[model samples]
Target: MSRTPNPTRTLASQTLFRGLDVVDAVADGCQSVQEIADRTGVAFSTTHRLASALVQARYLQFEPRRGYRLGTRLLELGFAAYRDSDIARSARQNIEQLAGETRDTVHLAMLDGDEIIYLDKIDAQRPIGVNSRIGGRKPVCCTGVGKALILDEGEASWRTRYQYDAERGNIHLPLETWLAGMHAYAQGGYAFDLEENAPGIRCVAVPIRDASGKTVAAVSVTGTTDSTDEARLRSLIPTVRGAAQAISAKLGGTLG
Candidate 1:
């Protein structure tokens, strides 16, 4: 009852592959009009047009002298893809387990440009904390779950992947603070939200891996600062971690 895809046809209009190529070309220090054209083997005029369009769409940046590079638009697109992906459905059980185990709000989030998109959530029974819901967005630089998922790629790589764009003139938390959190996340199995996204809501999170063993999502439990005490959070870690691992397994992850 199924069919195999035609490889050639699939590759031509493959948004994933094309998007990856665009991202890679820009990341590899490709600068300006000619550089991207030369690298992509796209005609100069066509490349110019594409670049202009991408810049307008926020997928590519055009500097006065430096030329084109990947833009925050990619993040927006990436987040949307991840949030709507099968991985999100695969992680539902994990979200439920985390919520039940911790008796707190549980959330599943996927990375967007420099933020995290809440694909799903299990609200707390106690109703003692923030009323986060599905489709909520939070800064990746500050949230516990977002930082932990980002840590799966190593500090340097995560920094590169989620680098802030000065062109947008959008600044929130300091880079140094974020870097410190990244270091902490690398050392710790789970990351802490620490009232970063909200003043009274605290959260703890673990990473969710996909079939290729890539951290594609983050599962987290959130509660009020008063309830997320050190002991309670510590007790909830293993439960959260186990749930994340189970979801990762469903996604075909082979976590090391």
Candidate 2:
């Protein structure tokens, strides 16, 4: 079910993701209508309509003789996004410094509905392939950077958004139980990913707030739990917060 989302994404961004499912299915070579429907869980008519919409938007092209091909709009939009994104421009230097200072992977992310998208990343001295890349998306509830980004939304929105976890097999938790932990994290001004998203990988994150106290972004330090102990990870909270605060300040954020 859909939930109230942040201003960064349209309320219908969830639906857009579903539409993107069709786009992804086609990209994966699901050529026929039936194949696309079977892959997308959308009805046959809906699939056809979505394809038509995409064709109209120039995100997809129909081949009367062939099947389908991606349109140039996707590439154009991708390039335009990278070029116009100000977060990476503002935060990349600070992220690099954080990585150098901590020797841990550092990331900058922005919330996109119930997911967070990586806007930039800086690898540490010891590279750990976290299966994450620029433009990659991860679930909000299970990620440190994600929780940090939403910390300001408080318990009610958290409850609504955290009702289901698709990647975690739709696991459900009591609202009170989850909110207690989230409130504590908010009070402390940071969050932790304790192997919640990916096994053996832990992360510490802090919210990047704008001048209006809105959490516009988040920054995180990530490392393997084996290499980064609880104490060491906790110690990184200050560094992560500093980096995030610096970026927020660069974006005209003023701590009230």
Candidate 3:
């Protein structure tokens, strides 16, 4: 299934590798052109030119003495791309529809590194509104939607990615708790937020499985404590699950 590397290919160009090293050096806090050159073993002139090009492209910012740092433009572009993503587009209508149906705030979230990133939300018609914003992050260990998404990933992944913070008081819990919750989720085909993320808010989430049957995203509904009664939320599960299924279908998810 594999071929050996060509010696010529491996040895041919030092410039490409040097350029990569310069970038790595810059990212690691070698702000000054000279510092970058020294750190990367590239020529000072080359480092200067590369740094200048990066600054021009707005990937880096230049300071007279401090040299350079990451630019705000990268963050702006990243958020723009994320907001306009296919996941966001596919989930938007369903999230809104669910919110309308349940008179609750609905959210769409995805995993980003070690945390859950909220990509979009729809607010209920009530006087008080949910405070979560687009692009907000919540810890995976405590949030319902986040834990559900990971649990849907199966046991091995869950064990690999999360740890029990005993100091935080059975943060991972005994195996029994994890197993019971997962069993409930699989049986119900949906997950609960359970006021773990916030004291007063409760949420229900369903997986947005893709064509390959992978949990690529999650859709959730949130509401005030008074309205998020257990029975009321149990009744809302079908609506939330239906909305998620619609979104998954729109995104070409291979549902059986």
Per-residue lDDT tens digits of candidate 3, residues 1-256?
A: 8999887877656655776676667667888888898998878998888778777878778989687887776678767987779999888777877888887888899888777888888878775456677877777656667865775667766665456423344244555676577677866777776666667778888878888888888888888788778777788888888888898998889434
Indicate whether candidate 1 or candidate 2 has the larger TM-score.
2
Root-mean-square deviation (CA) per prediction:
10.9, 6.9, 6.2
lDDT of 1 by residue, 41-91 (tens): 767786676667667878788788776767997778767876677977788
* Candidate 3 local distance difference test against the native: 0.76
Candidate 1 vs candidate 3: the lDDT winner is 3
Q: Which stretches of candidate 1 lie over 4 Å from their true place?
A: 1-84, 157-177
Query: What local lDDT does model 1 show for residue 98?
Result: 70
Using lDDT as the measure, the top candidate is: 2
Q: How well is each residue in 120-235 modelled by candidate 2, as lDDT tens digits?
A: 88887896868788887888888888888888888888877787554355324455766787999989999988777888999999988777778888999999977897898889
Give the distance in Å from residue 72's predicted Cα in candidate 3 to where it truly belongs. 5.1
- lDDT at 109 for candidate 1? 86
Cα lDDT over the full model 2: 0.83
lDDT rank order: 2, 3, 1
Residue ranges of candidate 3 with Cα displaced over 4 Å: 1-75, 127-131, 164-175
As for candidate 1, its clashing pairs are 32-67, 211-252
